[model samples]
Target: MFQFLRKVLMIELAGLNRFLLGQDLDLNIINSEVSRCNNNILADLTNDVLSVKSKFADYINIKLGKKKQGEKT
Candidate 1:
C-alpha cells in the first residue's frame, strides 16, 4: 500500500515538474521543495499507521485477556 502511494506520488510530481518547467520555473528549486513535501507527507503517513497499529494491538490484547506492558490488571 505504501509502495503504491509512493509510486503515485512520483508520477504526480513528475507531471508537476514538467508543467513548471514549461512555465520556465527553476527546476532545482521546484525539485527541492517537492522532495521536502514528499518526505513530510510520507513521514506523517507512517506515524499515522504506527499509531493505528498500536491501537489495534491493544485491542487484540484486551480481547485475548492479555495485559499490555505496564497496564493495570
Candidate 2:
C-alpha cells in the first residue's frame, strides 16, 4: 500500500504546487521514490532530501547568473 500512497501523494502534491519551487520539491519527492531503498523508510526519506539538494540552488543561480536563491522563481 506504500506504493499506492506514494503515487497519490505525488499526484496531490503536483497539483497543489502553486509556486514552481513547490513543484520542484514535488519532483524531488518523485526522484526519491525512483530508488527502492530496500523498503527502508529512513533510506527513502534520505533519498528524497538528497534529491532536493541535487536540484542545487547554486546551479540554478549560475544558470540565471543573477537571481538569488530565495527570489521566488
Candidate 3:
C-alpha cells in the first residue's frame, strides 16, 4: 500500500518535472495542481510521523514507566 502510494507520488512529481523542462503540456495548470498535491502529501506525512512518535512514547511510558526525574504523568 505504501509502495503504491509512493510510486504514484513519484510519477506525479516526475510529470511536473517534465513540464518544467518544457514538455508539451499545459504548464500553468500542471504547476498549480502539482504544487497543491506536493503540499498536501507533505502535510499528511508530517502528521503521520508525529502521531507514530506520540504513540510510541505512550507505549514506553506505560509499559516501562521510564518517566524522567521530576516529571509527572
Candidate 4:
C-alpha cells in the first residue's frame, strides 16, 4: 500500500512538473493527493512530497521573477 501510494504521488508530481515547466501552475491534483497521503498516516511520504512541491513552487517563482515577501534578494 505504501509503495502504491508512493507511486501515485510520483505520477502526480510528474504531472505537476510538466505543468510547472509549461507555466500552468495548477496544483489541485498534487495538493489533493498529498492531503490524502497525510490522512492515510503517511507522514514521512507526505513531508517529502510537500518538500518537492515547495521546490517546484520556488522554481516557478524564480522563473517568473517573483520574490516571496520578506525574502532577501
Candidate 5:
C-alpha cells in the first residue's frame, strides 16, 4: 500500500541522507535498484520533497509575507 511504501522510502532516505551529508555522492546502483521497482505509488515516494516544499512554502510565506530571494519553499 502507499503507506507501507512511504515508510520504506523514509527509512531508505534516512540512510541516504546520512550518506549525502557525509559526502558519499555515489547512488548509482541504489538508483537503478529503486528505478526497477518504480510504480505509481512508488513514484509518489520520490516526490516526497515536493510535499515538504509545499508545507515549507506555506509556512515561510505566512511568516515572511513573501518568498525569499531564492527560496524554493
Candidate 6:
C-alpha cells in the first residue's frame, strides 16, 4: 500500500516537473528546484515510515508484556 502510494506520488511529481519545464523557466533552474522537491518528498516519506514503525514496535512490546503478566497469574 505504501509502495503504491509512493509510486503514485512520484509519478505526480514527475508530471509537475515536466509541466514546470514546459513553461518559460530556465531548464537548469527548474531542474534544480525539481530535484530539491523530490529529495524533500523522499525525506518526508522516510520519516513517516520510521515514525509508524516505532509506534508499532512500542505497541507490540506493550501487548506482549500484558500477555506475560496474565500468564504469570
Among these predictions, the greatest lDDT belongs to 6
Global fold similarity of model 3 (TM-score): 0.56
lDDT of each: 0.74, 0.57, 0.73, 0.67, 0.64, 0.88
lDDT of 2 by residue, 1-73 (tens): 4576577656755554434434545676655654333246446655876776677866786877656544765
How would you encode candidate 4's per-residue C-alpha lDDT over 1-73 as one tens digit per residue? 5577778867866665565556544578656654665465556777877887799999998866655544656
For lDDT, candidate 2 versus 4, the one ahead is: 4
Off by over 4 Å in 6: none
CA displacement after TM-score superposition, residue 53 of candidate 5 (Å): 0.4
For residues 1-73, could you state the per-residue lDDT of candidate 3 as single tens digits?
Answer: 4566668768877876676657565778667777887788768866876787799889988766655533654
Better of 2 and 6 by TM-score: 6
lDDT of 1 at 23: 74
Quote the RMSD, in angstroms, for model 3: 7.0
Collision pairs in model 2: none
Q: Could you tell me the lDDT of residue 38 within candidate 6?
A: 86
RMSD of candidates 1 onward, in order? 5.4, 16.5, 7.0, 16.9, 13.8, 1.8
**Per-residue lDDT for 16 in model 4?**
54
Q: Residue by residue across 1-73, what tens digits does model 1's lDDT show?
A: 5677668767876776676567755778877877786687668777877887899999998876655544765
Give stretches of model 4 more than 4 Å off. Answer: 1-41, 66-73
Ordering by lDDT: 6, 1, 3, 4, 5, 2
TM per prediction: 0.60, 0.29, 0.56, 0.36, 0.34, 0.79
Expressed as tens digits, the lDDT of each residue in 1-73 for candidate 6 is: 6888689888979898888888998889998989998888888888988898899999999999999999999
In model 4, which residue pairs have backbone atoms overlapping below 3 Å? none
Residue pairs that clash (backbone atoms under 3 angstroms), model 5: none
Pairwise TM-score winner, candidates 3 and 4? 3
